[model samples]
Target: MPIGMILWRWDYRSGAEELGKYPKELDVSDKTMMQLYSQHLYGAQSDIVSMYVGALNIISVWTGSTHNYFLSLLLTIEEQPEDYKEVISDLLYYLIPFIEEDTFNTLLPSIYQRCTEFPSTNLEQRRAMMYGSNLNRAIFKTLSEEGCFYRDELKIWLEDILKTKLYNFEYIIDGLVQNDILKTSIVRGVDGTYVFLLKYLICFRAPPLDLSQKIKIAKDNELNQKILKKIRDFFKKYVPNEQDNIEIAGYIRQTNYWVIIDFLRKSYAKHSSLTKLKLHGVDQVMNLVNNLINSDIVDIVVDQNEEQVYFLKSDIILDFVPMNYMINQIYNMHVEDRKPDKLLLSYISILKENYLESH
Candidate 1:
């Protein structure tokens, strides 16, 4: 089938901004794109269609502007349902490196919704998938997956992972850190050298500060004597709500509710900005994460690994343990009709007192 008619019909003017986004001085060459997408494209008369489409897609990704070609790639789930997951995953592979902040944040939820159609791909997905690769595994894998390390330690680790020497690697490091995706700590040397060390990444799923502030004010009395019952019901209420309760709710409360405490533990991890949710019962866990996110108990979500990870707001306990906060406010909602758990009944009390402590 001719792809030209499809894109033209779908995008034609795409929008009025089309002409303005592309400047003639950029000196884009047909050979450049042909060589880049050689694997996906063959030298055919039909190649003209792909070149135009490719230009639009790259333009959207870099400039944060939405045109039909970029929109087509995003709506692949609805438009091209066959093999949708693989195609979307491929888009994510290279999309992260250059996607503009507004474009990424606004469209990601839509991208993730389609992603939900398939089963869990991997819990090991990392933000590194968004950057340049020398045609192999992503080079930033170690930084994303590994825990705390010194500046020199990371340089050596990257060399080991990429299997080559990195010359003037600081420039590369500067881009990764400076971009809105990741932020690093600034340290200066005695010789006036500047070294950027990865501190934490900003999860795209994070809630806005105003949401947190509004939640804090509105739900002031969320934690009362009845919180124990609410906590117990959280595990029991959602257990049966899922279609496949066996795998999804296997760890609900029957397994001693390890997931709840573990989430708290992840908050204290060196990364601090994001907490990796255990995938043992990802289906139900995600359901719970969504609830917490709405309740303002958690700040954000990142699904870079196909498995979802969340950000729990830690500042609630940063200054002092107040009577009301995200952790305790989790117990505010009402429980459904389910027998109360004797163990979870008392577990809430311990979680409240030891808000700072997690095992």
Candidate 2:
């Protein structure tokens, strides 16, 4: 039978409980397409590749519900006995590139979970790891190569996934730290988490920064001295001299930045405009504030009196809607099970009324 015929059977598989299973004739030959054709099994040999391509094209054009159902079947198929595994694996290799990102994310965690679940045999376990890792690497490559606009989105997704996998930091230290995936090429456009990982390897395992160089960074500046003191104290306490200290400093910086961002976020929600951030109260987080300003997420104005005022950027309000609106919508959705997106969009529609009028 033609490959397309097999796929048609698979797609319209009748029994819900046996969703992914199909006739064994589809798995008859592991040989090349030409070999199958030469044997006069499925008519022309070229039909093998052509039919498989046709099935993929059909799947790609499926509506959301149909696409989801197809994924469900593939997921089920992968978990079937080893004899049926190659078909699912081959299909995933071709299909994953065409899968919508949201769908890929939805299916990936479950696939990963299965990979980690206990296997009946050593061979099965190895196969699980091989397939799982290949899928991960493929997804990462696709996302990273996807354009500049998606860089941060991919980074955030990877960081979230890695966090779930690496229950303890040591797993990263022992495993991924030395991996080529974290090498500069792969992490080029991403953000903090990857940077922190590389830094950890350098600071802990690489030669410690020269004492003189460290002193130079701290100089006679009071703020520099204070920040350096905190960083040094963290490293001294947590870093083994023989290991890397980079992650410790990074963890401190990340935590400090998060705290500052959280404070500003809450303040922005409660009061759309902030006349003062009390920077003096969080001098250690000055770097984060400067970074925020550069990113245009927050606006800081210094008046003639030298008093500082901070507000969420107007574009943020227009793009994401107000935090207050989000909170209220979330509450209604939780309690009343209302659709918040429509309401949120309506609020966002009118959000810039005053700003536009003033301009």
Best by TM-score: 1
Give the local distance difference test score of model 1. 0.32
Clashing pairs in 2: 200-247, 203-245, 204-243, 204-244, 204-245, 205-244
Tell me the deviation in Å of residue 215 in model 2. 9.3
TM-score of each: 0.24, 0.20
Q: Runs in model 2 with CA error above 4 Å?
A: 1-220, 239-359
> What digit string (tens of lDDT, one per residue) describes model 1 on residues 1-359?
11111111112243222211111123333343333234133434211212233423221111121222232232221233333433243444333432433344444443444344322322212222221133212323343332123446566767786675544244345544454222343223222222221223221212224433444454323321122233334434432221232222222222213354235433321222222344454345545655544543443433334333344442111111222232222233214312123322333343444345422
Q: Rate the local accuracy (lDDT) of all candidates.
A: 0.32, 0.32
Could you tally the backbone clashes for each prediction? 4, 6
lDDT of 2 by residue, 141-221 (tens): 332332111234444555565553221122222233244222222232333222111111112221123422544554345
